[model samples]
Target chain A: MRVLGVDPGLTRCGVGVVEGVAGRPLTMVGVGVVRTPADAELGQRLVAIERGIEAWLDEHRPEFVAVERVFSQHNVRTVMGTAQASAVAMLCAARRGIPVALHTPSEVKAAVTGSGRADKAQVGAMVTRLLRLAEPPKPADAADALALAICHIWRAPAQNRLQQAVAQHALKGPIR
Target chain B: MRVLGVDPGLTRCGVGVVEGVAGRPLTMVGVGVVRTPADAELGQRLVAIERGIEAWLDEHRPEFVAVERVFSQHNVRTVMGTAQASAVAMLCAARRGIPVALHTPSEVKAAVTGSGRADKAQVGAMVTRLLRLAEPPKPADAADALALAICHIWRAPAQNRLQQAVAQHALKGPIR
Candidate 1:
């Protein structure tokens, strides 16, 4: 399966596409950053991010979209912007009928590095090795996006099976 | 000016429209809430909000759109949802080329009750009085939205003139 991962942010959003399945080597299809000027209006910035995500979707056509979930930050203002950017990514995927998954920072780190507390340097190194790249993707955010894509590709199969099983059980009829 | 005010929320988003100018009697144009099931997926909830806001924009065609600026709250999850909803509102307005403004809770309270520290009841009572309504709008969220509309109508003029002055000054060459 192909996955498009988004590391959502107000000033710099990262987009990465990975093509692979569990227990297989992944190939990097595309990677880039969508940057918006901090001085621009909030609405304008959001529109820019939305357009960027839409363009990526059109180009990559990934089977699944993974977004970094917004978690608490000491700086509330920054967190708010991150959350807004995350929402814009989700909206763009929903508009195109693409399934979206949210992965927490720790979840992504653990999936890539086998440690939920892995630092940026460790995650970067692991991502490079996993994708067999010449070097780690620049700006860290881009690498993070690739990491999310890898995490989803590895995790989603089990999740989908569980959901299917639940649905099938429900279809059998309600319990008395 | 006619203003569309949005009280952003994940489960129940309050929307209201009011028409009037500064120092003039205001009239209520519309008021309603857009609710999504609590168990709905995050992306689905956001799409519901987007559709609701789009419908409001198309139907009312208000001159201005006012959204509640999310502030820090104890509940991080709740705050994130609010921020997401707020973004969707802004996105809908920006897509339509409609001017949008964000008003803080304190600003709305101050505009309606002459006190930034005014309680919800005070703001609601004042909204009813200013709009010349027979009773306060039900579900405090609706009243808060109307207050935001009234606040923007009263505040935007001065803000717009200030922005225009800055732009004009910039065009006349840089100040020494």
Candidate 2:
């Protein structure tokens, strides 16, 4: 399956597209960032982000899109932005009828580095090794995006199973 | 100074603009959202977002932009989209040489409700009351956008002071 992984940030959003099939390693198709200025109108900045994502989607045309979920603490402003960003991704995927998946940081880290608490540097290192890259991915955001895609490929079955369980649970009125 | 606040999202990203002076309440000029189709291509949706934001900017030009910073946790896919959306906002501002400021969630909540733990409903209520609106803001995102603008106004002094301190700290480091 072709998958697109994203690492969201207001200033710098990273994107990576990969194509892979069952029992096959994923191949990198594209990776880059959408950046906004430090000084600009909020509406305008959001517009820029929308345009960048659109460009990436047009260029990559991945079948599935993956993104990181927000688990913030004690920061409403940050959380709001995160929620907003998340909504945007969902909207983008939904608009195109593409299935979107969300992965936790720990899940991605563990899938890539075999450690749930791996830091950015460690995760980057593992992604480089797993992908057998000549050089480590530049800018932490890009590396994170790549790792997210890997996590989806590695854990696709589990995720599908989990979704089924959740659906079943919901139908049964919450399994307490 | 004039400040614009954005509550960025995919389906609907809210934008609010306000004018502020020292020790004075910020005046609201405009508030609205950019709506995108959930079933459209990413590029088309982004184009819609860009057009929406541009229209807002053209109607009400604010001097500064305040956006909520995005922080991700579990869902990498979602975070990536959020990051891209945010990049759009930043890029729009940067292109016009407008100053952009990012605020954490807590800071915004604290500024609006005097409590960082306030929920979305609470924040929305407060924003409506503060703005003396005839009715509650249509969508939750719009209310949050207005709140962000208010938060920027209230926190401007502290932010400026913090920036100065950081600048001073950096200046004290060895010159390169």
Candidate 3:
């Protein structure tokens, strides 16, 4: 599957597109960041985010989008910004009629590092080694995004089975 | 200014494109809902959102995009869906180089009802009265979006002044 992974943030958003299936090394398609000036108005920053996502969508055309699910954080402002940024990404995928999956930070870390609590550096190193790349992906955000996609790949079987069961149940028609 | 207001949701997103300034009745240029099947995968839902936003952007070319900010909710799934929908709208604005403003529920309610605690029906009534529409905007979501644009207009003066003050302060250099 072609997966587009996203690390959503207010000032900078990391995006990575990769293609591969389980038990195989993923191929990197594209990776980049969308940046907004810290001093810009909220509205302006949101516009910058939107533009970046659209450009990425138009260029890469990934079949699936995977994003990190936001857990509760101490800073309300930061959480709000993160939520908004993530929302923008989800919307982008929706517009393209692609599927979107969300994984927790720990899940991604575990998928990339062998340990759920693995640190960033370790995860980055593992991603590079697993992908057989000479160098790790640039910027921490990019690596995190790639990890998210990897996590989705690892968890795809259970997700697919659940979806199939649900579809079958719905197809049975209304209960009397 | 032409402002596009969006009420982001999973099943149906209400959008309104209006043109006007503070203290003046805004003209409704266009209004509609972007919808997706509940049974659709998250990715497909996102694609629907993107197409809907793109269509609106193309039709109206609004200079500003106003969206209702997401708040904490009891349902994690609902919140996730809402966040994804909001992201699509934000990206749509950014791709076009248009500014986006996010308004809190309270802020919009206050703008339309003089009380931040006002309920949806009251806000809808005010939107009808303020815009001189023959009837209130259907589906509280659409009216709420219109209210958000009105809130932005009301708050623009203070925001502009703040921006100018910051600009002037930067010019003055470091304090002794």
* Predicted candidate 3 versus true structure: per-residue lDDT over A1-176, tens digit per residue: 77889999978899888788777767878877888777765545666676687888889887778988886443545766787788777766776667788888888988888789999899889878866778888788988887787778767967656766888989997678
Candidates in order have lDDT scores of 0.88, 0.72, 0.77
Comparing 1 and 3 by TM-score, which wins? Answer: 1
Worst 10 residues of 3 chain A by lDDT: A71-80
Could you give the CAPRI-style class of model 1? acceptable
Measured against the native two-chain assembly using Cα atoms, what DockQ does each of the candidate structures obtain, in the order listed? 0.40, 0.09, 0.24
Question: Per-residue lDDT for A105-161 in model 2, tens only?
Answer: 899899888899989999989878777788878898888888888888776566645
Quote the lDDT for B58 in model 3: 92
lDDT assessment of candidate 2: 0.72
- Please give each candidate's TM-score: 0.91, 0.52, 0.72
Q: Please give the ranking of all candidate structures by DockQ, highest first, separated by commas.
A: 1, 3, 2
Better of 2 and 3 by DockQ: 3
RMSD values for the candidates in order, in angstroms, are 5.1, 10.6, 7.6
Off by over 4 Å in 2: A74-82, A158-176, B1-176
User: Candidate 2 vs candidate 3: which has greater TM-score?
Assistant: 3
In model 3, how large is the Cα lDDT of residue B72?
55
**Residue A41 shift from truth in candidate 2, angstroms:** 1.9
Decoy 3 TM-score against native? 0.72
